[model samples]
Structure formats: structure tokens, C-alpha cells
Target: MKAIVLGTLMAAVAATGATFSKSAEANELALSLCTYVQGDDTMRMRKKLRDSRVRVRDIYSGIQCNGQSLLQFAMSNGSQDIGEFIVGRLSVDELKSSGDYEWAQSNGHAGSPIAAAIKERAGL
Candidate 1:
């Protein structure tokens, strides 16, 4: 029984990974850039995202490249951790004034996983 349970858990994890793999490509790229920002490449990522051609907002609206952006990748994957790092480093105003906040409060995504993370770090 224990072996069966472990196998089932592993299978579930694998399936979840597969599902996340199918997520929007732009969102995924944005998340990757977020990770890079959270890592040591904040400057490079910021510059890249700032380019007019980079429109992560289309994938998940309410994302603007101002220093105020609270954009994040999918929480179930590695994006959440990177997001947390970026949130910790960003200023309070940036966190509070992010488009994610408006979208979360106005839309039904109030407790959205990513928004929740931003709020938690931003102290909003």
C-alpha cells in the first residue's frame, strides 16, 4: 500500500508538471524573465521586458513594465519562488501600485496565487 501511494503521488506530480508545461508561451517566458530578475540578472531582465515588443500583458493582462509591475509566473512551477525573491527586493510602492493589485481587487482574482504572493511581500 505504501508503495502504491508513493507511485500515485509521483504520477500526480508528473501530470501536474505536464499540465504546467502546456501553459501559455508568453507567460512562461515572462516567468523565466522574472526568475532571471530574481536571480542576478535583474538589470538584463528589466531591459528585455521593457522593450515595447515584449507584451506579457496579453497573456495575463494588468502587467505593465513600470518598476511597479508585480508580474509573476505560474505558482505551481518554479516561478513562484523567483517571484517571491523579486517581491522581496522591490519597493513597497512598486508592490502596492502594481497592476496585479487592481486586477485582483477589481476582478475575481483577489486571492489569486500570484497576486497573493505580491501582496504578502509588498505588505499590501
Candidate 2:
């Protein structure tokens, strides 16, 4: 019985590790999607991020926001359409909880003055 219990525990740990690994991979994919989106490579962004199986926003959390939100990342970089799309998809609280709102309000739109004004206008 003890042996069986130990084996189960070990299996559980391995499974958790595997799950985390997958999450990390998904996070990387999401960041890549953002990069493509920022570059206005919508075709690739759509192709990469369209799958519902991936939690794009959750993966986005892993991205270095540079004290700015995903919206700021998109807007300041000339990806306003994608920024709007993400805003439409994400709930207000999700935006806040993700720290994007605070970052946007504080970071000055990743150092872009125009994006900073946009952020202020949007009430971010």
C-alpha cells in the first residue's frame, strides 16, 4: 500500500510538471502571437492565435509588458486594430487583474507619447 501511494504521488508530480511545461509552451506561443500582431503581420497572428485551445491572454501574462499593458503594446507599436480586438475580447476586470490597466496608465504607453495620449484618452 505504501509503495502504491508513493508511486501515485510520483505520478502526480510528473503530471503537474508536464502540465506546467505545456503552459510554458503555450505562453511562448501567445507572446509570439503578440509580436506578430504588433508587427501588423495579421495573417500570421490569426493563424497562430486562432486556436481556442490556447489561452492567449493567460500566455500573454508571461510576456514582458515593459510596464505597459497588452493594449499599450499594440497601440504604441501601431497595432491599434489588434489592441481594440483584444480589448473587445477581454473583460474590464480581466484587463485590470492582468495589471495591464495599471501598467498602461503608468508606463506612458511603452514610452510612445502618442500611445500615452491614447491610453489616457481611453481611460486606461
Candidate 3:
């Protein structure tokens, strides 16, 4: 069996914050810009955006992990800044089909950014 992956990365996570690894393979080391969103750090997100144009739009509009889009992940996890950014970037169809916007809306999560941003746009 593979190594049990047990030790808490919590301290490191709390120190650096959200989804990271040390001494990873080259492929694994290629960081995702969505990480900043997942981290809920606008400053780091903006910094990453300025630093590289690589997967930003695709990640914002389309990328998915474990049955959820970046927007889905952001909203589910209460990352509003990132969710608002995703709201600005993604199309309605994209949100409907891929970003979990519909689920979030119907689920009545008061803190869900997808629902909140759309409602805000409509001046509700």
C-alpha cells in the first residue's frame, strides 16, 4: 500500500495557508491559480494573476475538482472574493452547467456568492 499520508500539514497550512506541498514532482509543483481563490486571499490571487496568465480564465470558468468547479469550491467553502471574481468571469450557461451556481442557488445557502452576486446585479 502507499504511504498513509497521516501527519497533519496543519501548522504549515496555517503558516502558508491553503493547499501546498514541499519537494513535489515537477508536475505536482506546477501550482494552480485557483489555490489563491481556495485560500480566499485576494492579494495573492491578484499577485498570481499579475505574475502569470496561464490557467486563470480556464480555472475561473471551467476547471473542476472532485465534482466541483472553482466557483463551486469557492462558494461551498465561503470564499466570496474568489466567487465574485468567478461570477464576473463566467457566463450564465457555464455557471448553470459546470460551476454549480444552480445548486448553490436552490440550496438556499445565504452566504453563497453565486446567488448573491447574481442577485446583486439584478439589484435585489
Give the candidates in order of TM-score, highest first.
Answer: 3, 2, 1
RMSD of candidates 1 onward, in order: 14.4, 5.0, 11.6
Instruction: Report the Cα lDDT for residue 48, model 1.
Output: 63
Give per-residue CA lDDT, model 2, range 14-119, as digits (tens): 9999999988876777567667767857667656766646545555555554444566677567776666556655555566566555555565655544334444
Off by over 4 Å in 3: 1-31, 106-111, 119-124
Which candidate do you rate higher for lDDT, 1 or 2? 2
Better of 2 and 3 by lDDT: 2
Clashes by residue pair, model 1: none
Error of 2 at 44 (Å): 2.7
Task: State the lDDT at 124 in candidate 2.
Answer: 70
lDDT of 1 by residue, 12-99 (tens): 9999988787566556565656456445465565566666355333333444233334343333233454455556555676667555
Model 2 clashing-pair count: 0
Candidate 3 residues 40-69, lDDT tens each? 876776666666554454545434544566
Residue pairs in clash, model 3 = none
